[model samples]
Target: MAQRLADLADQGCPNFFDSQRFGKDNSNLKRLAQWINGDINVTKRHEKSLLLSALRAAEFNRQLGQRVQNRTWQTLVPGDVAILDGSNSHFSVASVDAELSARAAANDIHPAGVLPGADDSIAGAPPLLAELMQRERLQRAYRPLRLRIQQLAWQFVADDLILTMRLPRGAYASGVIRHIFDLQSD
Candidate 1:
């Protein structure tokens, strides 16, 4: 189990926003959809913010999921927005070269996925999210697709495994756990 964990740690985890970002049973996302379609109105500032956050998180997750499916989550692709490690700074990729590939492999940078909003030109955005962007006039952004796990350590106590690691801000611990265990969220 320890060796397996080590191997998994070296591979990093998909930078997915865990279920908590969507609220209970993803109620926030549902509400955002309702508001987008004009079926409901969100007037409160905090409520509006929450709905917007959920929308962005959902879109980011969708984009990251696609990269994972295509086995490109950890590799550089043409036209990818690459984010600098430990920073929000990112740059658009015109093409993938050896330097970019090496930086990605060394965890010096990561491929970013889009957070849908106004002026987001990336094609194939979901119609609902695109509509929300058009209605809200929100600014688009990017988030890294791979999360690096630092100082990973694990131990067994009384037949239970305990894991510890440091993740960057806005990163979910469950993102690491999912690679080692099957997680079901309610």
Candidate 2:
């Protein structure tokens, strides 16, 4: 399927087509290039359709990109992610924190009691305790899958694009996309 789309995109697909995940058919696709031109003419419907296709494309891109990213634990400080080193041990960092959170929530964990906010003062508390709280929260966020990698392969058709992502066992390919979309997983 992707090979076909790649061929189509390379030559310019002569007709509109859609991947079931993206849409039925995009009437607005032709208009996407209009924004780059000077003085565009668009009726209300054309503008709306164009906007929809662009939005869908943006969403598709976002999800596709995450496939190569590492899944982190949640209860983090709202920034940064928990990355796993080759040893499979986890470390924390900034960026893609939402992915961490989603992983945690999926595992039925939350950050509330895990993180020791600055105000926390317990007698002889280990300095690392605070850090541990934050990371443990991330551990809970894991979605039952051990650390793994996902990848998105793309095929562009003259009409539209098809995106593909393969996930690890116990991980949901579509569930990952739900990170960006409000749509329920079927």
Candidate 3:
């Protein structure tokens, strides 16, 4: 599909085929290791095997970054909270405000056990989609962007090989950047 798009005179999908996708590594990788095989409680070789699988996943993501190297940055400001506004636009940053900020925490909570009165029909839903819905939601931690991420702002720069996201005390900037940056090890 990508190769086909490349052949087009005008090129491929502007937002995805030619846009940057930064994936993040779990900061808890070390801790997860301890829980899996660091001589904790009952350790099993299987735990180590699973850990290896995780490492492989992270490594694979790193390789994906290389694949998207030619992708462009859609109007995404450095500190912007790039929210996926559906498949139409890659993302649109919402200026942080008390009202918008109020929903931040709620949105980040991963759904666990069923809601008190929620219907369990779970019918007509794909198990995968349902599970994904139950997965914890990512919180926005981007400090209000100092500027707009205009497509024509400047030549997209891929500066630091090691990128650092300093989010607000209560925000999850990484939560947002995780979607675009490679936070995994090579």
Candidate 4:
């Protein structure tokens, strides 16, 4: 069972953001658009923080969409930030090589995209994504573009199935659920 769990974890999960990220009626996104348009004037620290987060999340989602369209969301690209599985540590891959592709395919490393911010530490991103970061005034930072489940187990009970799993800190559960279910919007 332990080996099976490890094998399952190595299969990897989609690196997409779920609806919960957009908030109720995507109000966070509306707030972000307002801030981008200079229509919002925030004096409170919390308000500023939320707006910043919304801005970043919006950009991340946009980049994720592009990756999915390009069919590279599950694979590594040249000049991509490859994040090490289970660690915050990551390094830039200047070019895609067979070994790197194999490693990424094995779920040992993940390709990351930018989380717009002004931080100087965020480096080695694709040119277009970096440009978008500057235009959005999002601090340039990298976030693992993938999520890997740990200790995942499942069983069928009657007509329903139950899953037990652990995700890394900051990983969203909705991403995993989406793969197995067609969630509806209410």
Best by lDDT: 1
Tens-digit lDDT string for candidate 2 (20-119):
3243464343343343232355557655444444433433334223432433222344433333312323445354356766655443222211112334
lDDT of 3 at 11: 20
* Reference-based lDDT, residue 11, model 2: 23
Better of 2 and 3 by TM-score: 2
lDDT of each model, Cα atoms only? 0.85, 0.36, 0.29, 0.71
Measured by C-alpha RMSD in angstroms, how accurate is candidate 4? Answer: 5.5
lDDT of 3 by residue, 1-186 (tens): 223322221221122111121223453335344443433432465643343334333333332333346331222323334332211122333444554343322222110111111122233433432332233221112122111122211122465333333332322333333333424424
Candidate 2 positional error at 14, Å: 29
Stretches > 4 Å off in candidate 4: 1-8, 119-138, 184-186
**Predicted structure with the largest TM-score when compared to the true one:** 1
TM-score of each: 0.88, 0.26, 0.22, 0.78
Candidate 2 minimal-lDDT segment of 10 residues = 9-18
Q: In terms of TM-score, which candidate is stronger, 1 or 3?
A: 1
How well is each residue in 20-112 modelled by candidate 1, as lDDT tens digits?
A: 899999999899878877899888889988998887898788889899999999998999999998898999999999999999998899999
Candidate 4 lDDT over residue span 5-48, tens digit each: 45556775556666666778888767756665567755676766
Clashes (candidate 1): 0
